[model samples]
Target chain A: MNFFFGIQNNLFSSKLEIPIFKNDGTFLEETILYKLKIQDLEWKIEIFDKSKKNNFFFHVNSSDVNNNDIFFIGRHENLKKFKSNKLIVLNEFTSLVPHGYHYRSNLRVNINKGGFSSYQSDYPYKMTPVKGSVVTSLASVTNFNADKNYIFFKNIYELPIQENFKIYIVDLKEKKIKTFFEAKTNYSNFFEIKKEYILPEMFLVSKNYVGIPIYISEKNGQISMEHTNPPTSNILNSDRIDIVKKFKRELNEIIN
Target chain B: MKSLIRKIINLDFSIQVRNTLNIIPKGIQKKVSNQSSTSDAFIWRTDNNFTTKFKFSDILKLYFKIKKSHVELHFYSKFNNLITIKKIYDLDFSNEVVISKNLLGGIEDYGVFYAYHIMDEKKSQNISVNNKCYTGFSKDKEFYSFVHGNTLVRTFDYYTNNQNELVQTSFIKNKNYLIQKFFYSSEKNELFFTNPASKSVKFDINGKNFKLKKGHSKLISINDNFVKIRSNCFYFRPIAFTYNEKYFDVYHC
Candidate 1:
């Protein structure tokens, strides 16, 4: 508790400087987590109130400023969309006061999923603050630790008495599952897709980029979905449809 | 020349409108942007060092509801098994206020994940009439153990004695057999147990026998130096002796 307050106080007093990093173009594909860079190691802070509203402020030391113009940019989650907001240009250091209505829960000083830039010249790129749909083509930043964490998602349906099926790595070694992705219900039709279980290395690398396809099958008295084949990268120049296409292809491969 | 001047005036007017729209508040920015197609762009920079510096495995986040107004956070750092408890009073997205924090030796049992407050030993005492496995720590915080049925199934002790260094000790119990009675005497440093039999017979700490049909207590004495068959013995301090099958056998020793 003391350490947390100490960190926060140091941030506001400009004794601590937090670096913000971005890798949007060619470098996005190579790394699982992007690294931050510091222009002058300025103190970046986000203060929040009880109303679930937050304010972002940056304290710049006069000695650290090598340029006159400073550019501050913020990207935060808006409802369901994660988009970049307007860029502010500050001439004087005092102009870097607290601004904007940030969500309290989403406020963070360093461990956030956005970028900030402070520069002397005008921002080279045009700023689009409009709320837009999330881009699926962007490389995912999710990573799973084999020892502690797992990739968890659900495939739920409501039409037939509410069927909820989950996919999990039951056996990481053999990638074997006597029953995987099948909704455990009184319903007779339930089969899991098992062929898509790739090697541990490949599964860990590609699980974030793509998802395993669910295949529906009719066998004996049960009509079930078979879980087969591991997921592959859908990164075809930022097209999310690659995920659907990969699923469809795997379904066909299992059926034929 | 007149038409060219008119086109330049329109361009200037649109840019002015766009700049004016940006000045509106954030809540209104959404509605106004929906009406018009213009927007402002901002570059996003994330601190990637956060993810690299702390792996998800290192920190186990546990939430405990303290009253209705606030929620207590227990961040169990697996690196050193340090438990830091912080509180958020308003239940909003604001920074949490540190209430009280302490460092535990390590995760004593699998129940810590399910247990809200490990300090509250009663919370970890999971009991059932049928065959059940229970995990918890001893009172003095010196010893942690997992018991199944009537046996000290697994023990994790952090005592620093040359003879009995109480670090982590995981003992796998035979799942097929159910221990009807288990007694551990810290004074003697011995353990005793029996299998399911007549409920009329109950063994006390003095190794006095009521019935000896399925008693494996004598056999334990041969293998384990901590087991002795004697009468009029001094009761073990922090004795983890199970009197009945229903009681939680967590002792201070």
Candidate 2:
């Protein structure tokens, strides 16, 4: 049975990565992988050079392997070599059954005495397997401290090629649409949302391609990171596909 | 014959039966357009100096010229008791509901709140019936950490006036687990579990045992990076809250 399972190749790969934030404070980042019921699961970690010239693959120390999971903690000295680079984890497992593995990139930062914040990476790989070109996405903006809030767009691809797209910020209250920012695939983009643009009925939309829109806010020493859900999550019935199509069509018509 | 045997071994029949049953009721009530609705079980926190709020919008308004629409928030206590139900009428394109002790009749604690959309069927077309909104958590009013609903745990049929619970037992048990890794360096690492099942659910993190009654919630503290959970329920993922001194982060794990 194990031999047949190994030869069947019924595994789907889930790859996720995040760019290391440049902070003056003490920062530590690690990739945490949780093992479920996948038998003989295989995984790897790769680091992209800041210059975007080289990709290096390394192995996690055997000591870091716990009873049911693996932790690939980054070293300060080694991470300095690729500052602002990307750390990617690729996990291949058979999702044929109902069980699967979970992994996330965890970061801890300490700026001042008794000041610390921890964040977990939320962007899962969405471009791989090339589902489609257009996606309707929505996310809320957190403008607690206007000057300290920034929106991060991390678009990754299985292939090394890059694609250009524009993100539209839709103000439902004002009934207007504006091109907020232009981003390239395979790169991490960050920009500050003006305080004037932040309103109660505000949401970000992307029509060209799909990427993770992460809201990050920092005040004093605390930092909060979160991502938005796909538009289809609003409906739970089997006919959600048709409903989402209508929703997206009407939304695009209104925006255009 | 060999392929049929393989399919049977994979529990294809059981899955097909479950899917058929799920759609049969909807098919029978297809005439009642208002009966279709989608809902999510949101987490509400008003305990230990933590405040929770949910932000939503009238997405169906984009498709139909909505005459009237509102959201029904069914608030539950920590013990899974239905405490209060608040209705937000005449919603704008965007709105928010701040969960507070006073709003919940001074029931101060953490629990689950299920929010569903209610619209005037005569004046509007009900294509999409729910807005799976985002929930925000704040401490001391410093900053808000927001996250969306993680699963579709429950749904309400307006025509039949029946609430359907979705998260429950799977065909196979003890074959699945929910696991997450957290750093031990944080001052506090807590995992919030809400039982959406109609019956009680039994699960354990690491070796510590816990039993959560139907619709109840429990918060467990973790001091290690390696955490494993085994539960009888299908969707047993928990919301993770990590606090380091004055800074904290909340997300679905």
A14-106 in candidate 2: lDDT tens per residue? 122222221111122332222211122223233322221111112222222222222233443433333123323332121112223233444
| Alpha-carbon deviation at B138 in model 1, angstroms | 32
Name the 10 consecutive residues with the lowest summed lDDT in model 2 chain A: A1-10
DockQ of candidates 1 onward, in order? Answer: 0.01, 0.23
In terms of docking quality, model 2 is acceptable
Alpha-carbon lDDT, every model: 0.20, 0.55
Highest lDDT model number: 2
**Candidate 2 positional error at A143, Å:** 3.6
Off by over 4 Å in 2: A1-91, A94-126, A129-141, A144-147, A173-175, A250-256, B1-34, B63-67, B122-131, B170-175
Q: Considering the true interface contacts (CA pairs under 8 Å between chains A and B), give the fraction that model 2 also has.
A: 0.27
CA error at residue A162 for candidate 1, angstroms: 3.0
DockQ score for candidate 2: 0.23
lDDT per residue (tens digit) for residues A133-241 in model 1: 1111000111111111112121211111222333333332243332333332112222322333322211221211122222222112111111222212111112324
Tens-digit per-residue lDDT, B58-99, candidate 2: 655644446476778898887878998899887776667778
Candidate 1 scores a chain A TM-score of 0.23
